[model samples]
Target chain A: MVFHYPNGRAYDYHKNENHPSLVNKVNHRSINHNRSKTIYGNRGMSLEEEINESNQYYLSQGIAVIHKKPIPIQIVSVDYPKRSAAVIKEAYFKQASTTDYNGVYKGKYLDFEAKETTNISSFPLRNFHAHQVEHMRACQKQGGICFTIVKFTKTDELFILPADLLFKYWDEQDKSRKSIPKAEIEQLGYKLNYSISPRIPFLKGVDLLIANS
Target chain B: MVFHYPNGRAYDYHKNENHPSLVNKVNHRSINHNRSKTIYGNRGMSLEEEINESNQYYLSQGIAVIHKKPIPIQIVSVDYPKRSAAVIKEAYFKQASTTDYNGVYKGKYLDFEAKETTNISSFPLRNFHAHQVEHMRACQKQGGICFTIVKFTKTDELFILPADLLFKYWDEQDKSRKSIPKAEIEQLGYKLNYSISPRIPFLKGVDLLIANS
Candidate 1:
C-alpha cells in the first residue's frame, strides 16, 4: 500500500525498506483487529500489531489503559452518495506530532514510541523524529513516564529504553555515532520476553522504570 | 460535512442538529488549525475550535500536553498515481472507542470528552457513547483524571463535570431523566471563565478537580 505525507510527497514503503528511519509503516491490516485477542505464536505480526494486542490484553485485565493513537489523515474531499455512507474521495496522511502509544498506567501517565530494526548490532537513531523527541522531552518535564520500545527483529529481541537515555544520545548524535549500539541498550535498557497473554509484555519493564524513577 | 460510522450509517450533521446526543459534530475546520494561536474575541468559533486553541496555548506554555485524538477512519481503497501522492478513493469513519481529548497534566493522566448543547434546560446524557463512558470509567478506576466539558451554547456557559458525577447521572438515566439539569451542572460542576490566550481556560477547573480528588 502507498501512503503520502501532508506535503503531497509519496511514501513508498517498499522503496524505503532499508531506510534506517522507516519504522512503523502504517499497517492498515492491523487497524481492524486492534481489539482482537492475541493469536499466540504469531511471530509474523509487526511490532505495531503486537503492541496493539498487548494493549488490548492490558485493557482486558485492568492492568493499564494504553492505546495507539489513530493515524492522522488530512481529508480533502468527501462524497455523500444517496442511500450510502460518505466516502473520502481525497485524503493524505499527516505526520503525527507526538508518540504513538500513551495512556494511564497505575496512575502514572505513560507515553512511548515503538520501533523495530533488522540490524542486530544497533538501533538507528534516525528511526525517531525530531518532533517526537521534543514531545517526549516535554512530557518528561511534566513528570510523565516516557520511553521507547525497541525490537531487534532479527533475533525477536525487545528492549525498553528510558527516554532520558534516548535524550542523551539524541543530543550527542552530532558528536557521536548515528545509532545506539545493541551492547549499550542491553546494558541500560530492560529486556522483555514474549508471553502468551499479552505478547510483548513490555509493561514489566515499565514497572521497573517506575520503581527506578 | 458528512461522516459515516464503521457500519455504513451516514451521519449528516445538518440533519442531526436537533439530536440531543449529537454534541461534537466532527469539526473538520478545526483540524488544520490545531496548533494555531488563539484569535482573541472569536466568539463565533465552536467549542472544539476553542478547546484546540486552548490546548495549543497550554502546550506552548509548558503547562500540559493534551491533544485531541484523530478521527478514526477505515480506508477501503487508495489510488497511487504513476508519479504523484496517493489519494484515498474510499473510506468510512469508525466509531471512537475512547474519549476525544487526553494527555498528562502535572504528573497526572487527564482524559475528557467535550460536548455542547443548545438546549438551555439540560445536557443530554445520550450525547456520550457507551464505549466512551466505559473507557472513562476504566481510566478513572486507574486513578486517571476524567471529566466532561459541557457547554450550554445558548448562554455561552461552560462547565467541567467530574467523571464520577457523570457516571452517576449516566447510571440513573434508565430510571430517571435522560439529561442532567442545568441547575445540577451549575451547582456540581466548575464553571470555566474564558481567557484571552487559551480561549477556554478549563485547566484551572482541572486543577481544582485534582486538588479535590
Candidate 2:
C-alpha cells in the first residue's frame, strides 16, 4: 500500500522497512500466519510500540483519545543560542509515579499501564511499583476506568486485568506469592487479539469489561 | 507556613528567597493585599506556580487528581556513569500538541490550559496556538470537559472560560479581532475567589460551570 503526502511524496506501507531485526522476526512468523491467515502478525514490536500504534489508529478513527505520557526529564542546564532554539545542555530522566497511558473514551476516563513478560506461566509482581498501584487505586475511587494490559510474549496472548483484581494479588506477595499465574489471569481478565490495521485491539477487551461491570 | 520533609528538614514557604527580582515583584503588591484582605497574596508567584500549588491542595484533599504534564524534551546524547544514573548530555524542547493539565473529576474527564496575561482589558489571541485550540476541540468532541483558566495579571483576577466560548472568539481572529475583552469574559465566564488554604480556588468556578451545565 502507498500513502501520498500533500507535498506529493509517496510513503510505502511495507512492514519492517526500517528495522532489519524486526523484519527477521516477522519472517519467522510467516509460517504460522500462512497456516492461519486470520491472525495478525505482530512479530518483533514491543508492547509499548504496538499500543502506541493502536492509539494512533484509535485517534484517526475517532474511537478514543488515549496517549502515552512523554517520559519526564529533569533539565539541569540550558544554553541560549544566538540565532536558534535554546539547547538543553544537561538533563536526566525522572521516575514517573503514575501509569503510562490515559485519556477519555465515550465520556469515561480511561487510565492504564501496559507491560510484557517473556515467562508464559506467570507475570512478575515486580513489574508494577507501589506508587503506581496507589495511583490506580485513587483513580478507580474517583470513578475512572483503571486496568493493566499484560502481554505474554512467549504465547503471544494479551489480557486486560482490572486494577482491583491486580491489587488483590499484589497485596498478597509478602504472604509468599511472587507472580500471577496465566490460568488465574485467564479466569479474571479479558483476553485480546490483534487485527490487521490496528494491531492490538485492546479496546475490545475494555468494552467487555465495561459491559460486565 | 513551614512543611517538614520525611528527612526532618524544614522547608520555608517564603516567597523568592532565591530569585531577588521575584521577591521585589511580590513586595510591590504587598501594599494592595493589605488594603484588600479578601484577595489572595499571590504577589510574586508565576501563574504556573499558583496553579501547581492549587493542584497540590486539591490532590491532598482528594478533591481531584489534576496534574500538569511535564514538558517534553528530545534527547540527543547520553552519558552513562558506571555506578550512577544515566545523564542526558544534550536535548531540545519539544512542542506539545495537547493542553498542560488533565484529570478525572466526579466521573468527568477534565481538560484545561492555564494562561496568564499582563493585559488588563483583554486576552490577546496570540497567547494560544492553533494546535492547542484543535486539541481542546477534539477533547470537547469526545464529551470531555474543556476550558481555559485565564489569569489577568494586572488586575489579579482569574476566570474559567468554557472552550466553546473560547473557540468562538478564536475563530473571529481571522476576521481582524485579536483579543477577547474583559467585559465580554465577565459576562460569559465564571469568576473564582481565593480561599485561605487553596489560594487559587478555581474549582469553585468549575462547580458553577457544572451546576449550570
Candidate 3:
C-alpha cells in the first residue's frame, strides 16, 4: 500500500504486496469502540474510542480497568435553549492530554499513549509531545508501567514500545532529520497480534514485556 | 481583616482577625505554621496549578499518583527561532478537561474536578460541564470515588461536593434560574478543612465520606 503525503512523497508500507490476497485472506480485527462518534466522529475512529471498547472487553473478561483520559476542550460558544441539552456551538483544542489512558490491573498503575503512522519507513518523532515524554519518564521513574502502542496504519500492525526506547528515538530525532526507523522498531518493539474484541493485543505483549522487565 | 467584594459583601475567614496580637494566640495552635507553603498551595491556587502541584506531591510521596489531564491545544500560529524553543504566536482556549485530577489513591480509583467561584450567593452551575457530570456519574456507578472541590474564592472556604448532589442541582437548573446556592452547599456539602499540606484536605473528607457510604 502506498500513501501520498502533503509533501508529495509516496511512502509504501509494502504490506501484503509480495503475496497477493494476503490482506484479503487474513481477517481485520475490530475493537469494541463505544465512544460517542457524534462527538469525535469526523476525526475517524479516535484512539480513545478504540481503547474504551478494549477496556470494556477487558473489564468483562476481568483483565483490566483502563480508561482514556477525556480530551480537554475549551468550549468557546454554547447555546442553551429553553429546555433541552446545551450544544457546544464553537470549541477549540486545548492543551495536550497527560495520558491517553490510565487504570489499574492487578494492583498496578497502567499508563500509556496510542499513536499511529502511515509512513512505512519510520515513525516520526513529531507524533509525540514533549510533555507526554516527560510524563512517561516520570511514570517510569516511579515504578509504574509506561509504554506506547504504535500502529502502522498501512500494515495494520501494532507494537508496544517501551518509554526508554521512545526516549532514545526522540533524542535521536534531536540530532538529525530522521525518524525511528521501521528496522529499529521491528528489532526492539514487541509485535502485537491483533484480534476482534480488544483489537490491539497490547496486554499479551505487556505480559511478556513486564515479565522480562 | 474584612475583605469586601464589589457587591459590598464582606467576609473575614478571620484567620488574621482571630489573632488579636502575637501574644494573644495560643502557641500550640500556631505551631502548625511551620509546614511548608508548597505542601498545601492549593489554597487560592488556580485549578490547573493546584492539580499539578498535588500530582508532584503525590509523585514525591509515593502516594496514590494523580495528575491533571492535559488539554488538546491546536496552535494556529507559532514563531520558530533560529535556535530556540518555539514561541506560541496564537492559540485559543481548548475544552474543559475530563476531570481535574485522576489517579490511584490508596488502592482506589480517584477522580474529581476543582472549581472556584467569586459569587457569594451561589456557586454557578455553569462552572461544570454535562460531560463531566456524566463522567462522574459513570465513575460513581462503577463504585469509584468521585467528587468536586468547590472553592468560594472570596471567603477561601472550600467544600467537597459529591456528584450526586451536583447532578440534582444541575437537573433543577433547567426549571429554575438559580444555581447551587451557598446555603444548600452548606447543608449537603462536606467542608474540607484546610491543612498545612494539600491545603484542600480532600483525602480526609474522602476517608470520611467513603467510610460513611
- Please tell me which predicted candidate would have the highest DockQ against the true structure: 1
Residue runs of model 3 more than 4 Å from their true location after superposition: A1-100, A103-110, A115-147, A150-156, A159-213, B1-51
- Report the backbone clash tally of model 1: 0
lDDT score, candidate 3, position A191: 90
lDDT of 3 by residue, B1-213 (tens): 122334554322223332212111111112223333534434334444444555676666665567765433433333344544334444433344356577766556677887777788788887777767866766665566778878775566788887778889888887886488888888877887656555455777677667766
State the C-alpha lDDT per candidate.
0.79, 0.71, 0.60
Better of 1 and 3 by lDDT: 1
lDDT per residue (tens digit) for residues A10-123 in model 1: 434444233323345534234324524644343546677788999999999999999988777767666766666666777866678888889999999999998877788998
| Model 3, C-alpha of B120: deviation from truth (Å) | 3.7
Candidate 1 regions off by >4 Å?
A: A1-42, B1-23, B26-42
- List where candidate 2 sits over 4 angstroms from the true fold: A1-40, B1-40
Ranking by DockQ: 1, 2, 3
Q: Which candidate has the highest TM-score of all?
A: 1
Q: What is the CA-based DockQ of model 1?
A: 0.39
The CA lDDT at A69 in model 1 is 84
Q: Residues B1-213, candidate 1, lDDT per residue (tens digit)? A: 233444554433544343323345544333324534744244456577789889999999999999888877766666656565656677766677888999999999999988877789898887789989999999998889999988886577889988988898999998999988888888888999888988999999999999999
All candidates' TM-scores? 0.86, 0.81, 0.53
